[model samples]
Target chain A: MKFGVIVFPGSNCDHDAYHVISKHVGQPVEFIWHKETDLSGYDAVIVPGGFSYGDYLRCGALAKFSPVMAAVKEFAAQGKFVFGICNGFQILCEAGLLPGALIRNKNLHFICKHVNLKVENSNTPYTSEIAEGEVLSIPIAHAEGNYVCDDETFHQLEENGQIVFRYCDENGEVTDEANPNGARSNIAGICNQDRNVLGMMPHPERACEVLLGSDDGRNIFRSLTKAIAAHG
Target chain B: MKAKVYVTLKPSVLDPQGKAIHHSVELLGFEKIADIRQGKYFEIALDATLSDAEARETAEKIAKDVLANPVIEDYRVEISN
Candidate 1:
């Protein structure tokens, strides 16, 4: 299956996602510019991490209005897979494609390090290859990676099994110290109610290579292709 | 016409920046201050043709839809001129 990586101004990780999808995943991938309004030929779209629009107004706030986002929204509405990583997750939340908002880190500092995450739900297309409760080491880098939602939204997410991943210790235990960003309920990633749109603050592209530290993230890309094949 | 919009974090949301500011205020010997909250301020210039009521409505719309995220922030719009 082919994948498209959306490139916005100040998007530094678009190339990284493109490279991983093309080389490692052995999939045809293209870079979709923010101004482009077409996403007709791709099976999945990846909104990679970076400071889009210099993170003006707020992180992902300005980028949410980009021309490409309209197309991305349309793509998701069609049940096509859409994966948002890091700042891309923030953008998705800002665009209202996903629930909740990412606020400033509780420590008020930019955190850049690898953290352990437990796969909470593996039924979605993105995490199908990952076993439930499996710990994956993924790197997170952002000043506003704290995920927050109102009590009602949180309850809905919980009831729908939309919470896909949670921050956890190496032994797969959820703990406050393991929550690098102070996200509510230690949530690190979540999918929309339909389970087609996934947003996560951790950088999966950065963790796909074994030499880089962990190859655990490869399961996500592999699972995406598998899901596409099944759908076809 | 000119309008001013003020955007602030919702009361239920945590504000780390505001907390830091409160701590700094205490460090400066302002012991009487109980809390501090940070917010965004924007000055918008509107078309001169619009009447006062129209400008106010436009400013409020902008403040609610663009300047502030209703999920995490509350906003108020005031016509400046």
Candidate 2:
């Protein structure tokens, strides 16, 4: 299973994502530049986290227009898996490949720390290995991670079970509404209507190893591997 | 020609930054504070040769396609006459 990690300008997590997938997980992986328009050979693509384009206009605003996004969009349309982590999520949303937008932290301050996210829906291939309601501790570093959407869309998300993850307490209870990021309904991650694409604020790749203090995120990658194999 | 794009969160959408600012304003003892909502402003300069309808179409298309998420936000374009 070959994985292609897309690296945009100011993408600091390209190497980190590559390290976890290729070195740690033993999945063949390669780097795809932001300018690259071809993604035909790879089975999956990952938009790693970082302040792309120096986060000049907005978190992922400028990076959305990169040449690679055009291909990413095309690939996603063909039923391929695309993972967007943190700032990568912002870019996906900005590019209209996903819904909602990442706003500034509710408190208007940069938030960096480990957070517990409860798996809401595991029916998707990305979370198939994760049991529903299971809590996974992952690290989040961002100033704009607040997810916002209209009431109708919010209702639709709930109705369709598209809400994938939410911030929660240590005991696996979702709480602390007045938290740092100010994400709506405590949402930390979500998926598109088809559930093929995933965009989350937390870094699962960072938690795939014990050296990172937890292996809770390994299941996500493993699940992807299983799903791809099954698809074959 | 100069154009301004106004992007705002759709109705019934939560605006945490705006809410926080409203709270701060209230805390500062602003008795007349009613409400607040955050939005984005863009100033675009385009070629003068384009017709008003062309420019408006361009702005609206981008807004609907990219600059704003129609599911959660709405945008309006204002062009200089």
TM-score for the first chain of model 2?
A: 0.97
Q: What is the C-alpha RMSD of each candidate to the true structure, in Å?
A: 0.8, 2.5
lDDT for A218 (candidate 2): 91
Candidate 1 deviation (Cα RMSD): 0.8
All DockQ scores? 0.84, 0.49
Residues A1-232 of candidate 2 have per-residue lDDT tens digits of: 7899999989998898898888766889999999999999888889999999999857898898899999999989988889999999999988888888888786777887888999999898889999999989888999999898877778988998889989998777878752458888899998988887889999988888887788888988888878777766
Docking class of 2: medium
Lowest-scoring 10 consecutive residues by lDDT in candidate 2 chain A? A171-180
Which candidate achieves the best DockQ against the true structure? 1
* Model 1 lDDT per residue over A1-232, tens place: 7899999999999998998899889989999999999999889999989999998898999898899999999999999999999999999999999999999999999999999999999999989999999999999999999999999999999999999999999999999999988899999999999998999999989889999999888998888889878866
Q: What's model 1's lDDT at B67?
A: 87
Residue A86: error of model 2 in Å?
Answer: 0.7
Provide candidate 1's TM-score on chain A.
Answer: 0.99
